[model samples]
Target chain A: MPQGQPEVVPDDGLTTRQRRNRPLLAVHTGSMKGKSTAAFGMALRAWNQGWSIGVFQFVKSAKWRVGEEAAFRALGESGAGGPVEWHKMGEGWSWSRKRGTEEDHAANAREGWAEIARRLAAERHDFYVLDEFTYPLHWGWLDVSEVVRTLRERPGRQHVVITGRYAPEELLDAADLVAELTKVKHPMDAGQKGQRGIEW
Target chain B: MPQGQPEVVPDDGLTTRQRRNRPLLAVHTGSMKGKSTAAFGMALRAWNQGWSIGVFQFVKSAKWRVGEEAAFRALGESGAGGPVEWHKMGEGWSWSRKRGTEEDHAANAREGWAEIARRLAAERHDFYVLDEFTYPLHWGWLDVSEVVRTLRERPGRQHVVITGRYAPEELLDAADLVAELTKVKHPMDAGQKGQRGIEW
Candidate 1:
């Protein structure tokens, strides 16, 4: 795409603006990092446009203080852009010092997906980020077919972006935009561990 | 990487914390829309860490009110995180209602690179984003070897990220992390034009 111009224009009957303004179902997936980071970046753009934003973290614990979460929460309260709501499934529950059983985590993930489904049905948010959501679908904790169907039929101008590794093929087929963040190189390859602010 | 852990730990004669805290040179390239957006997301994390940020937009016009720029400017002013300074070369100059010759734009890019070099020498910023910088190297407007050398030898712990398509081989070779944002699918394929708040 040259300066955001499409390479091949389809013979759609819609006007340029109409087609351009359509809501997007974007998926950021790959083994490399930056999947959720890129999704949060899009959320920033949506918030800048005064679009209500909702973030659901599936893998991270609610106690985990991600820098993006803090920044966005401050931005939401500042009344400069749009409102933001952050929720965590705490399935992986890192740093919480308490681990749930696999079955318990599966149940928790299902509950989280149910909440997202309800919100989608109600058209609650202009932008929805299912952060690390692919885990549930990949692990068969959530039904891939039902998730795809619901997202495909989601109403209003809601833009939903899902980020995680191993995104289901069904979800990718339903998405309008899919970004695969491939790693050519990483400092981790040089024996570096994750650091605060940079990695979190 | 499982929970930010390196797949293999090397015996590099450094402690975990020292190895983890090293600054990074990241390059976001490939034909996709979210390169700059993802880089901005990293900037948010850096800001939350109280790191001074400097963004140099090599392609966008100076007058264009990019949503990220506005949100970041507000964040900088609010004193909620670190300070942010944004600069534009106005090379593309879209929406500026004025067209500069190719040579003029090339000169402006060189000037912008010079400014970044000066800042790096002075350690003026903790984080630096060279937005759409690959265009200059790809078009032969700037010396790729020199840019790579300058970045590689830059003093202090300042982290640098360059974003754009067609990143030069030398730059990728020098970078510690290179994320290729491959476009799996796009709405533009359906003849969608770029829309405000999303594209800009």
Candidate 2:
């Protein structure tokens, strides 16, 4: 509610209310933490609005089982808000429990992107979270220009958020909102390691 | 789960496992969004870990209930995870639905701080989110030194996170992890007004 006022108002012809309702292509990209966490937070808000949610994790291991996945799974099943579907395109596509080669990982990442592209075309979900998605683009596994083009031309009123570090300039240019998390200080700097509840 | 490795490891006598389990005092601040959102996301992790969670909002209006409140309340009641308690020390302490004078707001903020301090002393919650607490310290409504000292001396392995803009120097100095979210760009920058679900 304390969200700041717009510093610049564009002359886009649309009324304020109409402009405000437009779907956002948000990017959470930076070297620090909370990129995916913030995206998940936004998904929580979208869910509260009764928007169907889809989350695709690109980097984290499926065996790790992050907290957002479990809580969202429960929230979706609770029948109190919107439906949630979580997909783990984990490191090497860990769902198969097989370690893959470099080419195999690249192929899997491309397959994951293709699935997301199909979903966007079909307008299957109101809100989609491509959690840690930038890695594939950064690693040159996914074509950045093509990804940007698909997102820019996404059909219907679906909101999509992409998160991870080193987001390609093309993707950032296409995104309507981008939040960069910078690390001022980290416990790791003081020899403290990540804890169970705090980090994951 | 994709959290990066520590660039530097200290010889602090504590084993890696012991250091990894240390409690964190995290601060999320700067002139951007996702401060409170990221904090709530971390709370989601804490909940999944079955930690008792307490959220005290120092700035957001209680009347304009944020989506996190509803979702967390649901999670707390569902008996599937941790217990959660949410307190809104809204603008003018709006729980009373009275627009208070400047002095009244200051007193209410002080009262809120005292409550948190007491809870810290009692080890009331395993995870604590002091949402938007820096404004009071920045506005001189609360003592920064005392607040920092209390958090530094909090009992047990409680993890505390404070979120807002312009965090006080002493608090930042004492914090274990500090994340400054820089707004690369926002829909607001393009004149889009805040909407119901996405903004709140």
State TM-scores per candidate.
0.89, 0.92
Off by over 4 Å in 1: A1-3, A62-65, A91-103, B1-3, B60-65, B91-103
User: Which candidate leads the pack in DockQ?
Assistant: 2
**Which residue pairs collide, candidate 1?**
none
lDDT for model 2 comes to 0.84
Candidate 2: residue B200 Cα off by (Å): 0.7
Error (Å) of candidate 1 at residue B177 is: 0.8
CAPRI category for model 1: medium
Best by the lDDT measure: 2
State candidate 1's TM-score. 0.89
Candidate 2 per-residue C-alpha lDDT over A73-107 given as tens digits, one digit per residue, 9 for 90 to 100: 87898778899988776555434445454446677
CA error at residue B6 for candidate 2, angstroms? 2.9
lDDT of 2 by residue, B56-86 (tens): 8887467444788888988888777899988
Model 1: per-residue lDDT, tens digit, B102-152? Answer: 448877787788878888999999999999999999999999999899999
